[model samples]
Target: MARSARPVVHYMATRPDGTVPPTCNHLARYYSGLGETIPTVNLADHIGETVDHPSPGEKWYTDKPFSYFHMYTRPGEILERLEVEERWPVRLWEVEPLGETGNWGNDFAPYWLMSHQIRVVREVEAWRAFGHRGMQVLATLAQLPDLARQWTEEWTADPEGTRRTYTAWEKRVDHTRALTGWAFCRAQYSRREAGLQAANELAGNAAAQAATAAGADPHAVALIQLRARCLVAGQLMFDRIRTGEYEQSIRGLLLGAGLETPAPALA
Candidate 1:
């Protein structure tokens, strides 16, 4: 549905502890007139396209959108699922840098996303009209595992299970795999703080090469910041095997990766 060219009011999602008066009777008032499930892109072009694959000849620069896209599956099909909300939810990835990598921001615009879904609603009416246009938008959101699996299958010149593993590093890394593993470990283990810290440290090291470097980009800073914020993910993991706080996850990684879990301090 073409927006009436009228102004629109958008709101940041409601927070965990914040409260908002539910006075806005029509929560979906903006999209009231528009069709449901508006396809922001060309639908016919995406037909028969693998929602999990990328378009050929289309180069993705390691910028915002494309960079964000690589961490998961094909962006085109993702938009399709998004049009229908069929996407499997997964952890959010950090925005990739532009410069020498690729100019993904202009084309992909991944930073605009919230969660696995492109969350900004286009007014209920807009969706209503979108629905009218023969768009088959599913209202349900995709599950996390579905999205995570898509991430686990990242494309690369690296050998099998090399880039696929939870360890081996990449400049702009896949955040979901580490995050999923961390979430699982945290849930299974009794040490909440220990797990979160270790997981964060792992994520930090994977995201960037430095921690306190003064000339880091936002892409790099985000990782450095994550490392600092989470306290000690690598340390926690290291401490555990060394002192046995909870050795299952570490031991699992050791055996799983075929790489010894460094009982020594985490790098």
Candidate 2:
């Protein structure tokens, strides 16, 4: 049978000044213990030759016979070898008991990516909860302006402290977005209500003239006109809140409220 191809892996090399990522030497030594020799290549040599050239500080391995295929071929063999070499203890309960086991530094790339995704999901959930709360509290059209003022006051009173407390970027953005949304809602509701009132008044005037001609009661016409206005106002408010023009009014509102624009979070 033909020999299976060896696996090629890479790690950051120990620098001339003797500085290196801790995991680099650990992984190189592990593969060396498995009877493989590692190699070093200067990235500058291949910079113009290949698009996917090696990065600086990278060391390459071309002689390692150990592969994922070998892992399954003899189940427990690699773990037994590791334990026998005294490099890793065979503990059943604890994963990564010997700390991080990758070529990268202490901040594992995979875990960092996963944590960022989790934070994004949490921020989205928080925004949804905020929107639901806004719907519950904004019972009347007149409350929108008041609520907006309240948010502005709360934000301005402690802008820096609030930003520091909500360190997440999404949380800060969501706060400004929510305030802009309320302002837009108030403006849209007022515009729609005014238009509807004008139209309703014209129709009411025509109806009142017709009812007078037909000798119908003026008091009943007046009651119907009042009910129409109330119905239109309520429906307009609800529709405006649901489908208001949500624009990027963050800068304007921040300045207007005498609050500084929120800075981006540090990496």
- The candidate that wins on lDDT is 2
What lDDT score belongs to each candidate, Candidate 1 first?
0.28, 0.30
Residue 230 of candidate 1: its Cα lDDT? 27
Task: Tell me how far the alpha carbon of residue 117 in candidate 1 is from the true structure, in angstroms, after superposition.
Answer: 47
- Tell me the tens digit of each residue's lDDT in model 1 across 1-267: 865765422212111222111112233233344543211222123223322212112344222221122221212122122211111221112122222223346445331322211222221221121112101211111122232223322312222443223233322123333334553364234223322433333334433433223344454345333323222333333333433533544433422322212222335
TM-scores across all candidates?
0.20, 0.18
Q: Which ten residues in a row have the lowest lDDT in candidate 2?
A: 113-122
Identify the runs in model 1 with alpha carbons over 4 angstroms from their true place: 1-176, 182-188, 193-213, 226-231, 239-267
Number of residue pairs clashing in candidate 1, backbone atoms closer than 3 angstroms, sequence gap of 3 or more or interchain? 32
The root-mean-square deviation over C-alpha atoms between each candidate and the true structure, in angstroms, is 21.4, 28.2
What TM-score does prediction 1 earn?
0.20
lDDT of candidate model 2 versus the reference: 0.30
Q: Compare the candidates by TM-score and give the number of the best one.
A: 1
